[model samples]
Target: MNFVKRAGTSLRARKARTVVLSGIFVVICTLLLGGFLLQAAAARQEADARRTIGVDVTVRGKGLGPAVADRLGRSAPVNRYNPVLPLKAEARGAQPLESDGPKPPGTRTGDRARHFLAVSGVRDSSMLLPFSYGSARITAGRGITPEDSGGQVAVVERRLAERNSLKVGDTVRVRSADHRRTVPLTIVGVFRDPTPDPPRWTPSHELPGNTLYTPVRVAQELGSDAAAVLSEAVFRIGSPEQAERLHAEAERLLGAGTFDFRVNDRAYRDQVRPIQQVGTFAGLIVWVIALAGALILALIVMLQVRERRDELGVLLAMGEKKRKLIGQHLVEVAAVALPAVAVAALAGQLAGQELGDALLDHRQGDVTPGQRQREPVAAGTPRAAVGPPAMDIGPVVLGKVAGIGLGISLVSTAVPGIGILRLHPRSILTHNE
Candidate 1:
C-alpha cells in the first residue's frame, strides 16, 4: 500500500486518538490567534494616541542666538517653529487706546484710563504664540504674514479697531513708549479675543482687548532695546518618542546650562499607557501560548509513539526503512492536524477580539481624556470592529496567527518524533534487549 494510504488507514483506525490530538490543536490555534490580534490592536492604539497629542516644545535660555530657531526647526522631532517678539506698542490720536506716558500723579480709580495695543511681531500667523494657543482668533481680513513683519502692516483686535475707527487697508500712527520713535501701521486684519474677563483686581490697561500683531522684525525695531536678544525658540515636535530623543540632542547643541527644554507630552503619555500595558501582556501571552501548545502536542505524540512500538517493530522487520516509517507517522499526524488547524483559524479569530477587548478594559483605567476622543472605531470599516472598546480581526492578524500555529505544530511534532528514532525493532518484537 502507498504511504499516504497507509497513513490514512492508521488515522481512521485510531479515531479516538485523532479526535484528542485535533482537539488539542484547536485550542492552541485559538489562543495564538487571539494573542496576535490583541498585539496588533495595541500597536494601532499607540500610533493613534501619539498623533492627537502633537509634539510641542518650548526652548528657553540666554544668548540663544539668531540661528537657534533655524537649527531647532530642522531637527527630526520638530514639526515647525513659531518665532515671536512681544512688545507694548504706543498709539496716538486713538480713543480708548492705552496712553503711552506714565500715569499722572494721584490718578483716582474712577479716572478715565487708556489701554495700549499688545503688539507682537511674529514670523507667521501659524507661528505666533497667542494665535497658536487659540486665545486670539482672527475674524476679519488676514493676519500679517512673514512678508509684512517690517513693512508697517498690522493686525489689530476687532474691539480695538472699533474704538479707533480703523478698517482694513487704513493707516494708524503709533509711537514708542519713549515718545522718540514712531511708525505708521496699515491695518491688515482684525481678531477677537475670546479670553474671559480678567478678575476685578486686574486693571483695564493690562487687558489684551486693544492688541496689535505684526511681523517679528517690526517688533524688534519697535523695541530697539540696545541689548535686545531672542529670548526663546519654540518648536513643535512630531511625536513623543522623537521629542525625548531630540531633547537630548538639542540639549547638547544648545548646551546644558545655556538652555532648557519644555516638552508638552502629557496627553500622549496618558493615552498610551494603557495600550502599552496591553502590549506588555500580549508579549507574555505569545510565549506562554506557544510553549503550552508545544508541550501538550509533544506529550501526546510521544505517548502515541510508545503505544505503537510493537507495530513499528513489525514494520521495521518487514523491510520498511526507519526513515520511511517516520514519514508515515508524520503523514498520519498531518492528516489529522491540517483540518483541525484550519478550523482553529476561524475559531481563534472569532474568540480573539472579545478576549482582547477584555484585556484592554482591564488595563484601561483613567488615562488622558484625549484617548476617549479617538475616532469612532467602526465595524467592517477596515481592521477594527464597531463593538464597545474596539475589537478587530483582520487578514494580517489571521496571517500572524497562522504562522505561529504552523511553527508550534512543527516544533511539537519534531520533538516527539525523536522518540521513534531511538527505537530498535528487535528489542520491541522479541521483548529482548
Candidate 2:
C-alpha cells in the first residue's frame, strides 16, 4: 500500500485523536482568519476617518461674508474655504414633481407647484453639511466653483429636480420670498436626500429637503439687503490640531467683531475615534494570535509525532524512504487542517464584525467628546467631504486568509515534525515501547 494511503487510513482509524487534532486546527484557523479580517477593516476605517468626519473650523456669525471666509481659507495652513449664504425663495422649475409633502393650500392639479426652499449660496455646495453626514449626496452634474462665481448657476436637490423635471443645464426660476427680486437660475447639478421625511421636530430646511446651492457671487448679488447679517464661513484645516492656531491667526488677521470664532472639531473627533480604536485593537490582536497559534500548533504536532513513533519506525524499516514517511505525517495533519481553514472563512466574517464592533465600542470612550486629536485628512477632493464607511473583508480577504492559514499551519506542523523525524528508525521503535 502507498505510504500516503496508509497514513490516510490511520488517521480515519484513530477517531479520538483525529477529532481532537481537527478541533485544534479549526480553532487556530478561526483565530488567524478573524485577525486578518479585523486588520483589513481597521485599515480601511483609519484611512477614511478624516473625510467622513469633515472640516476643522466653522466660523458662524452675522455677516461673516464671503470675503472674510475666502481670506481665512487662503490662510497659510488652511486648505479649503466654504462661505454660506442662506436664502428663502418660492422656487418654480425647481420643486420635485412627485407630491409627498403637504402641498400649499389652494393649489390646482396640473399646476407647477411652488415650494418654500431654503436656498444656500455656497462656494462649493458639495461641502455643505448635508453631504458631510451622508444625509445628502450630489448625484448629478458638477458642483459650484470659483470660476462660476457671479454666474447665474445652481445645483438643486434630487427630489426637487425630479419633481420639476430638471437636469443639468436646465433652468430653475427662483423668486425671492418678498417678490422684490427674481433670478433665472440654471441647474448645473442635482443632489439627492434619501430620507423621505425627517422628524417633525427637525428643522424645515433639513426635512422637506428643498435645498438649492448657488455660487456665492450670485448669492451675494441676489441675497436680500439683510442677507449679509446671517452669512457664515467654514474653513478647512489639514488636521484638528491646527484649528486653534489657525483660529487665532485668522482672528488676528481679521478682527473678530462680526463673526464668532468656533472650532468645529467634534464631528471629526466623533467619526474618527471609533475607527482608530478598531485599528489599534486589530494591531494588538494580530501579534498575539500569530505567536500563540504557531506555538500551540507546533507543540501539538510534536506530541502527535512522538505518540505515532512506532508507525513511523515500521514504515522506515520496511524500505520506505524517510521523506515518504514524514510526508505521510504531514499529509495526515494537512487533511485535518485543510478542512479547518475552509470552515474558518465563514466564522471569520461573523467574528470579524463582532470583534471590530466590540473594539470600537470599548475604545470609543477613550477620547473625551471635547478633546482634540491630530489625525490627518487628505484635502484633495473638493466635493467628497466625507467618505462612506468601507467594507474591506470580502473575496480578497478570504483568499488571503486561506493562503496565509495554510502556510502558517504548515510551518507550525513542520517545525516539530523536523525535530523528531531526524531520529533513527531503530531508536524510534525502541523509544515507542
Candidate 3:
C-alpha cells in the first residue's frame, strides 16, 4: 500500500489520537501566530510614533537669517523648518487684549493705555509650537505660509481680532516699537488662544490673546536693519535617533560655535518609548513561544511514536522501508499542521487585537498628558492614531507562521520517529509484547 494512503488510514483508525494531536497543534499554532502578529503591530506603531512626534532641533544665534535657516532646512535630516522673528509692536488701529490680572506696583497708566501686540514672523505659522500642539488654532481664513514670505500678511488671535472688529481680509496696522516703521498687514487668518492670563500684571504685547503672526520678511523689514534676521530657527527630523545626524549638519553649516543647536526630544521620548518597549517585548515573545511550542509538540510526537511501536514494528516486518515509515509519520503530522494553522489564523485574529490593545494601553499609560506635551511638537504634521496600534495579519505574518509551523512539524515527527524506526523489527515487536 502507498505510504500516503496508509497514513490516512492510520489517522482514521486512531481517531482519538488524531483528534488529541490536532488539539495540541492548534494551541501551539495559536500562540505562535499571536506572537508574530504582536511583533508586526509593534513595528508599525513605532514607525507611526516616530513620524508623529518627530525630533525638533532649535537653532539660536546671531545672524541666523532666512537664507541660513533655509540652508539648514535643506539638510538631509530636516523634514521641514520654521524660522521665527519675535517683535513687540504698538497696535495702530486695533485694541490689544489685556490680561485680567491686577496691576503690579510701579504700574504706569500710560503703559496701560498703550496698545501693544506680540508679533511673530515665520515661514509657516502653522508650525508654531502653540498651533502645532493644539494649544492654539487658526479659527478663520488661513495660516501664514511659506509663500507669504515677503507679503505683509498676518494671522492674529481671535480675541485680538474681535477686540478690534477685525476679520479676514481686514487690514491691521502695527508700528514698530521705535515708531520709525509702521506697516499694514492684511489679515489672512484669525486664531484662538486658550492660554489664560498671568496671575499678576502682564504687558499687552505679552498677553496670549494679543499675539500676531506674519511673514518672516515682514518682520525683518520692521527691524533695525533691512537685512533679514531670525530670532531662532526650528528644524524637524523624523526620530530622536536622527538628532545626531541633524546636529552634524548644523555644526557643518554654522561652523560649530556660531550657533547653539538644541534638540528637544521630550515628546518623542515620552510617546515613542512605550511603543519601542512593546516592540522589544513582542520580539522576545515570538522567540519564546516558537521555542516552547516546538518543544511541546516534539515531546507529544515522541510519546505518540512510542505508543504505536507495535504498528510500526509490523510495518517494518512487512518490508515497509524505514524511510517510508518516517515519511508516513511526517505526512500525518503535516496534515494536522495545515488545519491547525487555519484554525490558529482564525483564533489569532480575534485574540491578537485585544492583546495588542491591552499591551499598548498598559505601556502608554506610563506617560501622562503633561509629560507628553512638555516638548514642542512639529506643526502641520499629522498626529498619530490616538488609540492602540492596529494589529493586522498580513501575508508576511502568515508566511512566518506557516514557516514556523512546518519547522515544528519536522522537529516533532522526524527526530523521535527516526530513532524508533531505526530499531530492528524483531526487537521492536518483542519489546512491545
lDDT digits (tens) for residues 164-260 of candidate 3: 7999999999888778999999999998889887787788887888888988787876766666568889887878778888778777766778888
List the candidate 2 regions with Cα displacement exceeding 4 Å. Answer: 1-3, 46-49, 57-81, 84-121, 124-214, 219-233, 236-264, 349-393, 431-433
Model 1 TM-score, all chains together: 0.68
Q: Largest TM-score belongs to which candidate?
A: 3
Q: For model 1, name the residue pairs that clash.
A: 55-237, 98-114, 98-115, 98-116, 122-216, 149-215, 379-386
Q: In model 1, where do residues sit more than 4 Å from their true spots?
A: 54-56, 65-67, 90-115, 120-195, 199-205, 208-231, 238-256, 263-265, 335-399, 430-433
List candidate 3 stretches off by more than 4 Å.
89-116, 132-134, 145-152, 174-184, 194-204, 362-387
- Superposed by TM-score, candidate 3 places the C-alpha of residue 199 at a distance from the truth, in angstroms, of 8.2
TM-score of 3: 0.85
**Local distance difference test values of all predictions, in order:** 0.65, 0.66, 0.79
**Index of the highest-lDDT prediction:** 3
All candidates: TM-score? 0.68, 0.56, 0.85
Residues 104-188 of candidate 1: C-alpha lDDT, one tens digit per residue: 5676645544444567766566445455444466788887765664588888877778877788989887676566677887888
